[model samples]
Structure formats: C-alpha cells, structure tokens
Target: MKNVFSGDFTQGFPFQGNMTGNDPSGFPFQGDFSKSETQVKPQPEIFETNDFVYVKLPMPNKDNKNLKLQHTNHQLILINYPKENEQSKYMLPSPVKRKGTRARFLDDYLEIQFIRLDESNISEIDISY
Candidate 1:
C-alpha cells in the first residue's frame, strides 16, 4: 500500500477527480477554455534607420482617407481606427527630431516617420558626492 508515511510510497500519483468525470466547478469538463470571440486592437510594426524611425499600422479593407494620426515623443494614436483599437504607446529605441515628423496612408497601411537626431553632440553632466 502506497501511503504518505510509507517509505515505499512514490512521490508521483495519478490525478483524481469526481467519479462522474465532472470538473470541480460541477460542470462537465471540456478541454476548450476560450469562451468568447472579441475584437481587439491590432498592433503596428516599427522600425528604424540611420535617419528615421517608421511605424506601419495595418488596415485591411479600410479606406485610407478615414485614418487620422496623433503622436508625441513617446506615444501615438490612430483616431477612429477600427473604432476599438485607436490608441497605442511605444517606447522608442532612440531619440528623434519631432519637428519634421511625417505620416502617410497607402494601400492598407498607415505609415509614420520621425526624423532621427544626432545624439553625439549631447553632453553628459557629472555629479559629485
């Protein structure tokens, strides 16, 4: 007999549940866990070059004229895009020059570009104890 106190007892044991094969929730257990299908905001792809950082958002079967964009140094939003997924924030890999930022909608994607600035000229400060 394999018991907790017995030296011959193996650590591994078969999982046991209700004899009727129902889950602890008192419902017949089905392997499926997903309950509902809900629409979610789509994510954009971002990339960078020596002179610019670009973001590309997808909009399949949607009109380009309906797309609107707003952005700051660290955040961006596409107004009324699919209505549900209009806002998203991203962390930039490097600093960009915001003054000449540009955006365009083409085919099924909205693309935005931020000019990259030269960081080599930035100076470092020293702190003393």
Candidate 2:
C-alpha cells in the first residue's frame, strides 16, 4: 500500500501537473488576476475615537439640497444621493446618541460625526450552574 503522506500523494489529485512556470508564488492555477473585471465601488470610511464616531463618504456631483441624512443608534442612512430616488445605508462602528450628530458636506465629501453612546454599564450576572 502507498503511504498517503508521501511526496507522491498528489499524483492522483485533480490539480496534478497544473503548476505554471511564470507563477513565482508556485500556485497551481494560472490566470491574469489584474485583467479580471472586478471593480470596487467607493465605500464609506468609518472611524471612532474616544468621544465620537466619524463616517466620511464620497459625494461626487452631489448637492446638499438634494441629500437627506438620518440615523439610528446603529446605522446611518443617506437618501437622494448618487442618484435621484436612490438611498444608501451604512452601519456605524459603535452605538451613537441621536442628539449630537453633526453632518457637513464639503469638497465633494459628506462627513458625519456622531457622539459615542456610553456602553460601559455592563453588569456581572451570577451564573446559577
């Protein structure tokens, strides 16, 4: 019986003899990944500091009069943006209070600042196991 852990174990595999000479990383597949039709749309940038959570989104060819912004504790919503009657929703990094939100549109970018909600009131539960 042949040992499966031997060097020749890959002889009967489907990827056998499929290694390409031009691939420096020695991957078994061959394809020009750079020519692939995978395009990435612009995504919102989110960051949080000690006091605030910031979300910056690109608003190319957009106007403040045509945009509407709304938010809950966990999500931020943009309406009438990028196109008429179209809306985009973004998730916030942390829970935010509804009162202290500030939004500004400048230089083709929409920046929203949300005050972080205090979540440090965790209580220890006694397990009755």
**Model number with the top TM-score:** 2
Candidate 2 lDDT over 1-129, as tens digits, reads 266567666655655442543453555665664423543446999999999999988987754487889999999888886567878888998999989899887787888899999998989999997
Clashing pairs in 2: none
Off by over 4 Å in 2: 1-41
Tens digits of lDDT, candidate 1, 1-129: 645557755434344455343364443454534334445467788889989989888868565465566666666656667664355566666677768988776788878898876878877899998
lDDT of each: 0.68, 0.80
The positional error of residue 72 in candidate 1, measured at the CA in angstroms, is 1.8
Give candidate 2's whole-model lDDT: 0.80
- Residue pairs in clash, model 1: none
Error of 2 at 56 (Å): 0.8
Task: Please give each candidate's TM-score.
Answer: 0.58, 0.64
